[model samples]
Target: MNFIKSLDDKVWMTAKARYNASARLNKKHQALTFTISFLSVAQIVLTFCMLVDICFGFPEKVLMFIAMTTSVMILVIANQSALGSLLIESEKLHRFGIKFQSLYEEISLYIKLDKANKSVEEGFQQRYSQLLREADINHLKIDEELVKAERKSFELNPICALWIKFKNLVAIYLSSFLYLAIPLGLLWGASWLK
Candidate 1:
Protein backbone atom coordinates (compact mmCIF):
# COMPACT_ATOMS: atom_id res chain seq x y z
CA MET A 1 0.00 0.00 0.00
CA ASN A 2 2.77 2.39 0.84
CA PHE A 3 4.62 1.68 -2.43
CA ILE A 4 1.46 2.21 -4.48
CA LYS A 5 0.72 5.47 -2.68
CA SER A 6 4.21 6.73 -3.39
CA LEU A 7 3.84 5.82 -7.07
CA ASP A 8 0.60 7.75 -7.32
CA ASP A 9 2.13 10.78 -5.67
CA LYS A 10 5.06 10.58 -8.02
CA VAL A 11 2.78 10.69 -11.05
CA TRP A 12 0.95 13.70 -9.78
CA MET A 13 4.17 15.46 -8.91
CA THR A 14 5.61 14.70 -12.32
CA ALA A 15 2.55 16.12 -14.02
CA LYS A 16 2.88 19.34 -12.10
CA ALA A 17 6.52 19.70 -13.02
CA ARG A 18 5.75 19.06 -16.66
CA TYR A 19 3.03 21.66 -16.57
CA ASN A 20 5.37 24.23 -15.10
CA ALA A 21 8.00 23.57 -17.75
CA SER A 22 5.57 23.59 -20.64
CA ALA A 23 3.91 26.78 -19.50
CA ARG A 24 7.24 28.54 -19.44
CA LEU A 25 8.19 27.15 -22.84
CA ASN A 26 4.89 28.31 -24.23
CA LYS A 27 5.62 31.82 -23.09
CA LYS A 28 9.04 31.65 -24.68
CA HIS A 29 7.60 30.40 -27.95
CA GLN A 30 5.12 33.25 -27.94
CA ALA A 31 8.11 35.55 -27.72
CA LEU A 32 9.21 34.01 -31.00
CA THR A 33 6.24 35.64 -32.65
CA PHE A 34 7.32 39.02 -31.33
CA THR A 35 10.88 38.31 -32.35
CA ILE A 36 9.78 37.48 -35.87
CA SER A 37 7.63 40.56 -36.22
CA PHE A 38 10.29 42.81 -34.78
CA LEU A 39 13.18 41.60 -36.90
CA SER A 40 11.06 41.36 -40.03
CA VAL A 41 9.75 44.89 -39.67
CA ALA A 42 13.14 46.27 -38.78
CA GLN A 43 14.70 44.57 -41.79
CA ILE A 44 12.01 45.80 -44.15
CA VAL A 45 12.37 49.32 -42.87
CA LEU A 46 16.13 49.26 -43.11
CA THR A 47 16.07 47.71 -46.56
CA PHE A 48 13.58 50.33 -47.66
CA CYS A 49 15.73 53.04 -46.15
CA MET A 50 18.68 51.68 -48.02
CA LEU A 51 16.68 51.77 -51.22
CA VAL A 52 15.52 55.32 -50.44
CA ASP A 53 19.16 56.29 -50.01
CA ILE A 54 19.12 56.74 -46.23
CA CYS A 55 22.84 56.42 -46.35
CA PHE A 56 24.31 59.21 -44.27
CA GLY A 57 27.82 57.83 -44.47
CA PHE A 58 29.72 54.57 -44.60
CA PRO A 59 28.53 53.99 -41.05
CA GLU A 60 24.83 54.07 -41.95
CA LYS A 61 25.38 51.60 -44.75
CA VAL A 62 27.32 49.38 -42.40
CA LEU A 63 24.52 49.47 -39.84
CA MET A 64 21.88 48.67 -42.42
CA PHE A 65 23.96 45.85 -43.79
CA ILE A 66 24.41 44.32 -40.37
CA ALA A 67 20.69 44.57 -39.57
CA MET A 68 19.51 43.01 -42.81
CA THR A 69 22.07 40.27 -42.60
CA THR A 70 20.89 39.31 -39.11
CA SER A 71 17.29 39.26 -40.28
CA VAL A 72 18.01 36.98 -43.22
CA MET A 73 20.08 34.70 -41.09
CA ILE A 74 17.28 34.38 -38.53
CA LEU A 75 14.72 33.64 -41.22
CA VAL A 76 16.89 30.83 -42.48
CA ILE A 77 17.38 29.52 -38.98
CA ALA A 78 13.66 29.65 -38.22
CA ASN A 79 12.82 27.59 -41.26
CA GLN A 80 15.53 25.06 -40.50
CA SER A 81 14.80 24.73 -36.78
CA ALA A 82 12.02 23.13 -34.72
CA LEU A 83 10.72 26.66 -34.92
CA GLY A 84 9.56 25.60 -38.40
CA SER A 85 6.34 26.84 -39.87
CA LEU A 86 7.56 29.91 -38.06
CA LEU A 87 4.61 31.77 -36.61
CA ILE A 88 2.20 28.90 -37.08
CA GLU A 89 4.25 26.40 -35.10
CA SER A 90 4.99 28.96 -32.47
CA GLU A 91 1.25 29.37 -32.10
CA LYS A 92 0.91 25.61 -31.84
CA LEU A 93 3.37 25.61 -28.99
CA HIS A 94 1.06 27.98 -27.16
CA ARG A 95 -1.99 25.89 -27.98
CA PHE A 96 -0.37 22.72 -26.69
CA GLY A 97 0.55 24.62 -23.59
CA ILE A 98 -3.08 25.44 -23.08
CA LYS A 99 -3.88 21.75 -23.30
CA PHE A 100 -1.25 21.03 -20.69
CA GLN A 101 -2.81 23.64 -18.47
CA SER A 102 -6.17 21.93 -18.82
CA LEU A 103 -4.62 18.60 -17.98
CA TYR A 104 -3.05 20.01 -14.89
CA GLU A 105 -6.36 21.38 -13.77
CA GLU A 106 -7.99 18.02 -14.33
CA ILE A 107 -5.30 16.34 -12.27
CA SER A 108 -5.88 18.78 -9.45
CA LEU A 109 -9.59 18.09 -9.46
CA TYR A 110 -9.00 14.37 -9.44
CA ILE A 111 -6.60 14.66 -6.55
CA LYS A 112 -9.05 16.70 -4.58
CA LEU A 113 -11.76 14.17 -5.26
CA ASP A 114 -10.01 10.79 -4.93
CA LYS A 115 -6.53 9.74 -6.00
CA ALA A 116 -6.97 6.05 -5.22
CA ASN A 117 -8.53 5.17 -8.57
CA LYS A 118 -5.81 3.30 -10.39
CA SER A 119 -7.65 3.19 -13.71
CA VAL A 120 -8.19 6.92 -13.63
CA GLU A 121 -4.63 7.42 -12.56
CA GLU A 122 -3.41 5.42 -15.55
CA GLY A 123 -5.62 7.42 -17.83
CA PHE A 124 -4.12 10.64 -16.48
CA GLN A 125 -0.62 9.36 -17.02
CA GLN A 126 -1.41 8.34 -20.59
CA ARG A 127 -3.01 11.67 -21.35
CA TYR A 128 0.01 13.46 -19.96
CA SER A 129 2.34 11.44 -22.19
CA GLN A 130 0.15 12.01 -25.20
CA LEU A 131 0.15 15.74 -24.65
CA LEU A 132 3.92 15.76 -24.52
CA ARG A 133 4.24 13.73 -27.70
CA GLU A 134 1.76 15.94 -29.51
CA ALA A 135 3.55 19.09 -28.47
CA ASP A 136 6.83 17.69 -29.79
CA ILE A 137 8.76 20.88 -29.29
CA ASN A 138 11.52 21.55 -26.79
CA HIS A 139 12.51 24.73 -25.04
CA LEU A 140 15.94 26.31 -25.18
CA LYS A 141 18.44 27.06 -22.45
CA ILE A 142 17.46 30.72 -22.64
CA ASP A 143 13.88 29.69 -22.03
CA GLU A 144 14.98 27.76 -18.92
CA GLU A 145 16.86 30.81 -17.70
CA LEU A 146 13.86 33.00 -18.31
CA VAL A 147 11.61 30.61 -16.42
CA LYS A 148 14.02 30.43 -13.52
CA ALA A 149 14.16 34.19 -13.35
CA GLU A 150 10.42 34.47 -13.49
CA ARG A 151 9.84 31.88 -10.77
CA LYS A 152 12.69 33.26 -8.62
CA SER A 153 13.09 29.64 -7.50
CA PHE A 154 16.48 30.35 -5.89
CA GLU A 155 18.06 27.36 -7.58
CA LEU A 156 20.10 29.37 -10.06
CA ASN A 157 23.62 30.21 -9.01
CA PRO A 158 24.58 33.91 -9.11
CA ILE A 159 27.15 33.56 -11.87
CA CYS A 160 24.75 31.53 -14.03
CA ALA A 161 21.98 34.03 -13.46
CA LEU A 162 24.20 36.90 -14.54
CA TRP A 163 25.30 34.98 -17.60
CA ILE A 164 21.75 34.30 -18.66
CA LYS A 165 20.76 37.90 -17.92
CA PHE A 166 23.52 39.19 -20.17
CA LYS A 167 22.44 36.83 -22.94
CA ASN A 168 18.82 37.88 -22.53
CA LEU A 169 19.71 41.56 -22.73
CA VAL A 170 21.71 41.02 -25.87
CA ALA A 171 18.87 39.13 -27.49
CA ILE A 172 16.26 41.70 -26.54
CA TYR A 173 18.29 44.69 -27.72
CA LEU A 174 20.19 43.26 -30.65
CA SER A 175 17.55 44.29 -33.18
CA SER A 176 17.51 47.81 -31.83
CA PHE A 177 21.20 48.20 -32.36
CA LEU A 178 20.71 46.92 -35.87
CA TYR A 179 18.31 49.71 -36.87
CA LEU A 180 18.86 52.49 -34.33
CA ALA A 181 22.36 53.49 -35.41
CA ILE A 182 21.24 54.49 -38.89
CA PRO A 183 19.12 57.27 -37.42
CA LEU A 184 21.91 58.40 -35.13
CA GLY A 185 24.29 58.46 -38.05
CA LEU A 186 21.70 60.28 -40.11
CA LEU A 187 21.21 62.79 -37.31
CA TRP A 188 24.90 63.44 -37.15
CA GLY A 189 24.97 63.68 -40.94
CA ALA A 190 22.05 66.13 -40.72
CA SER A 191 24.60 68.50 -39.19
CA TRP A 192 26.18 68.57 -42.64
CA LEU A 193 22.81 69.94 -43.86
CA LYS A 194 23.49 72.84 -41.52
Candidate 2:
Protein backbone atom coordinates (compact mmCIF):
# COMPACT_ATOMS: atom_id res chain seq x y z
CA MET A 1 0.00 0.00 0.00
CA ASN A 2 2.83 2.38 0.90
CA PHE A 3 4.65 1.64 -2.38
CA ILE A 4 1.49 2.25 -4.41
CA LYS A 5 0.93 5.54 -2.58
CA SER A 6 4.50 6.60 -3.31
CA LEU A 7 4.04 5.86 -7.02
CA ASP A 8 0.88 7.95 -7.10
CA ASP A 9 2.71 10.80 -5.42
CA LYS A 10 5.52 10.56 -7.97
CA VAL A 11 3.10 10.89 -10.90
CA TRP A 12 1.53 14.02 -9.40
CA MET A 13 4.94 15.52 -8.72
CA THR A 14 6.11 14.93 -12.27
CA ALA A 15 3.02 16.50 -13.77
CA LYS A 16 3.22 19.49 -11.49
CA ALA A 17 6.85 20.09 -12.37
CA ARG A 18 6.11 20.05 -16.12
CA TYR A 19 3.13 22.34 -15.68
CA ASN A 20 5.18 24.85 -13.70
CA ALA A 21 7.99 24.92 -16.28
CA SER A 22 5.58 25.50 -19.14
CA ALA A 23 3.78 28.29 -17.26
CA ARG A 24 7.07 30.02 -16.50
CA LEU A 25 8.20 29.85 -20.11
CA ASN A 26 4.87 31.22 -21.28
CA LYS A 27 5.17 34.16 -18.87
CA LYS A 28 8.67 35.03 -20.06
CA HIS A 29 7.63 34.99 -23.70
CA GLN A 30 4.53 37.06 -22.89
CA ALA A 31 6.73 39.68 -21.26
CA LEU A 32 9.00 39.78 -24.30
CA THR A 33 5.97 40.17 -26.56
CA PHE A 34 4.75 43.12 -24.49
CA THR A 35 8.17 44.76 -24.47
CA ILE A 36 8.55 44.46 -28.24
CA SER A 37 5.14 46.03 -28.80
CA PHE A 38 5.83 48.91 -26.42
CA LEU A 39 9.19 49.61 -27.99
CA SER A 40 7.71 49.56 -31.50
CA VAL A 41 5.04 52.10 -30.53
CA ALA A 42 7.66 54.27 -28.82
CA GLN A 43 9.80 54.16 -31.95
CA ILE A 44 6.91 55.34 -34.10
CA VAL A 45 6.03 58.17 -31.74
CA LEU A 46 9.63 59.32 -31.56
CA THR A 47 9.85 59.33 -35.35
CA PHE A 48 6.78 61.51 -35.51
CA CYS A 49 8.23 63.87 -32.93
CA MET A 50 11.42 64.10 -34.94
CA LEU A 51 9.44 64.99 -38.04
CA VAL A 52 7.57 67.74 -36.19
CA ASP A 53 10.82 69.03 -34.75
CA ILE A 54 12.22 69.24 -38.26
CA CYS A 55 9.23 71.24 -39.54
CA PHE A 56 8.98 73.44 -36.45
CA GLY A 57 12.11 73.65 -34.43
CA PHE A 58 11.92 72.51 -30.82
CA PRO A 59 13.06 74.74 -27.99
CA GLU A 60 15.90 72.34 -27.28
CA LYS A 61 17.65 70.90 -30.30
CA VAL A 62 19.98 68.83 -28.11
CA LEU A 63 17.09 67.10 -26.43
CA MET A 64 15.60 66.33 -29.84
CA PHE A 65 18.85 64.70 -30.92
CA ILE A 66 18.88 62.64 -27.76
CA ALA A 67 15.34 61.48 -28.41
CA MET A 68 16.22 60.37 -31.95
CA THR A 69 19.22 58.39 -30.71
CA THR A 70 17.09 56.82 -28.04
CA SER A 71 14.49 55.80 -30.61
CA VAL A 72 17.16 54.04 -32.63
CA MET A 73 18.16 52.10 -29.53
CA ILE A 74 14.54 51.22 -28.87
CA LEU A 75 14.05 49.94 -32.40
CA VAL A 76 17.09 47.68 -32.10
CA ILE A 77 15.85 46.33 -28.81
CA ALA A 78 12.35 45.73 -30.17
CA ASN A 79 13.64 43.75 -33.12
CA GLN A 80 15.81 41.57 -30.90
CA SER A 81 13.02 41.02 -28.41
CA ALA A 82 10.61 40.06 -31.15
CA LEU A 83 13.10 37.59 -32.49
CA GLY A 84 13.59 36.06 -29.05
CA SER A 85 9.87 35.84 -28.41
CA LEU A 86 9.27 34.17 -31.73
CA LEU A 87 11.97 31.65 -30.94
CA ILE A 88 10.34 30.75 -27.63
CA GLU A 89 6.87 30.05 -29.14
CA SER A 90 4.96 31.38 -26.13
CA GLU A 91 1.50 30.52 -27.41
CA LYS A 92 2.45 26.88 -27.76
CA LEU A 93 3.96 26.88 -24.31
CA HIS A 94 0.77 28.34 -22.86
CA ARG A 95 -1.40 25.79 -24.63
CA PHE A 96 0.82 22.95 -23.49
CA GLY A 97 0.59 24.11 -19.88
CA ILE A 98 -3.19 24.18 -20.00
CA LYS A 99 -3.36 20.78 -21.61
CA PHE A 100 -0.95 19.34 -19.08
CA GLN A 101 -3.13 20.65 -16.27
CA SER A 102 -6.11 18.89 -17.79
CA LEU A 103 -4.15 15.70 -18.10
CA TYR A 104 -3.08 15.91 -14.47
CA GLU A 105 -6.71 16.30 -13.38
CA GLU A 106 -7.79 13.35 -15.49
CA ILE A 107 -5.02 11.18 -14.08
CA SER A 108 -5.88 12.13 -10.53
CA LEU A 109 -9.52 11.25 -11.13
CA TYR A 110 -8.59 7.98 -12.79
CA ILE A 111 -6.53 7.02 -9.77
CA LYS A 112 -9.43 7.78 -7.47
CA LEU A 113 -12.33 6.18 -9.37
CA ASP A 114 -10.91 3.29 -11.42
CA LYS A 115 -9.11 1.12 -8.89
CA ALA A 116 -11.04 -2.15 -9.24
CA ASN A 117 -9.08 -4.58 -11.44
CA LYS A 118 -5.46 -3.49 -11.76
CA SER A 119 -3.03 -2.96 -8.93
CA VAL A 120 -2.52 0.68 -7.91
CA GLU A 121 1.04 0.69 -9.27
CA GLU A 122 -0.14 -0.79 -12.59
CA GLY A 123 -2.88 1.78 -12.95
CA PHE A 124 -0.42 4.54 -12.14
CA GLN A 125 1.98 3.30 -14.84
CA GLN A 126 -0.80 3.16 -17.44
CA ARG A 127 -1.81 6.80 -16.79
CA TYR A 128 1.81 7.84 -16.69
CA SER A 129 2.47 6.20 -20.04
CA GLN A 130 -0.43 8.08 -21.55
CA LEU A 131 0.92 11.34 -20.13
CA LEU A 132 4.35 10.62 -21.61
CA ARG A 133 2.88 9.97 -25.04
CA GLU A 134 0.90 13.23 -24.90
CA ALA A 135 3.95 15.10 -23.74
CA ASP A 136 6.01 13.75 -26.64
CA ILE A 137 3.35 14.86 -29.10
CA ASN A 138 3.21 18.27 -27.50
CA HIS A 139 6.96 18.74 -27.77
CA LEU A 140 7.01 17.81 -31.45
CA LYS A 141 4.21 20.22 -32.22
CA ILE A 142 5.90 23.00 -30.32
CA ASP A 143 9.16 22.41 -32.15
CA GLU A 144 7.33 22.69 -35.46
CA GLU A 145 5.61 25.85 -34.34
CA LEU A 146 8.89 27.34 -33.24
CA VAL A 147 10.42 26.57 -36.60
CA LYS A 148 7.60 28.31 -38.43
CA ALA A 149 7.68 31.32 -36.11
CA GLU A 150 11.42 31.74 -36.41
CA ARG A 151 11.16 31.77 -40.18
CA LYS A 152 8.80 34.72 -40.02
CA SER A 153 9.97 38.30 -39.72
CA PHE A 154 9.00 40.81 -37.06
CA GLU A 155 5.72 42.07 -38.39
CA LEU A 156 4.43 45.49 -37.47
CA ASN A 157 1.04 47.15 -37.63
CA PRO A 158 -0.24 48.57 -40.92
CA ILE A 159 0.91 52.03 -39.92
CA CYS A 160 4.48 50.72 -39.76
CA ALA A 161 4.61 49.65 -43.41
CA LEU A 162 7.20 52.27 -44.16
CA TRP A 163 9.48 50.89 -41.47
CA ILE A 164 8.99 47.41 -42.86
CA LYS A 165 10.00 48.59 -46.29
CA PHE A 166 13.03 50.29 -44.83
CA LYS A 167 14.00 47.09 -43.02
CA ASN A 168 13.70 45.05 -46.18
CA LEU A 169 15.89 47.44 -48.11
CA VAL A 170 18.56 48.04 -45.47
CA ALA A 171 20.29 45.99 -42.80
CA ILE A 172 18.87 46.58 -39.34
CA TYR A 173 21.94 48.21 -37.80
CA LEU A 174 22.56 50.36 -40.84
CA SER A 175 18.93 51.32 -40.92
CA SER A 176 19.02 52.23 -37.26
CA PHE A 177 22.03 54.46 -37.89
CA LEU A 178 20.21 56.16 -40.73
CA TYR A 179 17.20 56.64 -38.48
CA LEU A 180 19.50 58.23 -35.89
CA ALA A 181 20.98 60.55 -38.51
CA ILE A 182 17.68 61.67 -40.04
CA PRO A 183 16.56 63.92 -37.22
CA LEU A 184 20.01 65.36 -36.69
CA GLY A 185 20.42 66.04 -40.40
CA LEU A 186 17.00 67.61 -40.60
CA LEU A 187 17.74 69.77 -37.58
CA TRP A 188 21.03 70.86 -39.09
CA GLY A 189 19.28 71.70 -42.34
CA ALA A 190 16.62 73.64 -40.47
CA SER A 191 19.27 75.55 -38.53
CA TRP A 192 20.96 76.54 -41.78
CA LEU A 193 17.62 77.92 -43.02
CA LYS A 194 17.41 80.21 -39.98
Question: Which candidate wins on lDDT?
Answer: 1
Q: Residue-wise lDDT of candidate 2 within 1-194, one digit each (tens)?
A: 45545555555455444443454445444544555455456557656766666535444555456556556656665675464653455444445556555655655675577564456457556766675666532333333223233333434354455544443234223433444456557556657756
The TM-score between candidate 2 and the true structure equals 0.43
Score candidate 2 by lDDT. 0.51
Q: Which candidate number would show the highest TM-score if scored against the true structure?
A: 1
State every prediction's TM-score relative to the real structure. 0.49, 0.43
Candidate 2 segments whose C-alpha is farther than 4 A from its true place: 54-120, 137-194
Q: Cα miss at 27, model 1 (Å)? A: 10
Cα lDDT tens digits, model 1, 1-194, are: 34344444443444444444455434444555556666677667767777877754545646565565656655653664334354454455556656766776776677667557777777777887777677676444565565565445447887778887777665545544544454446545655654
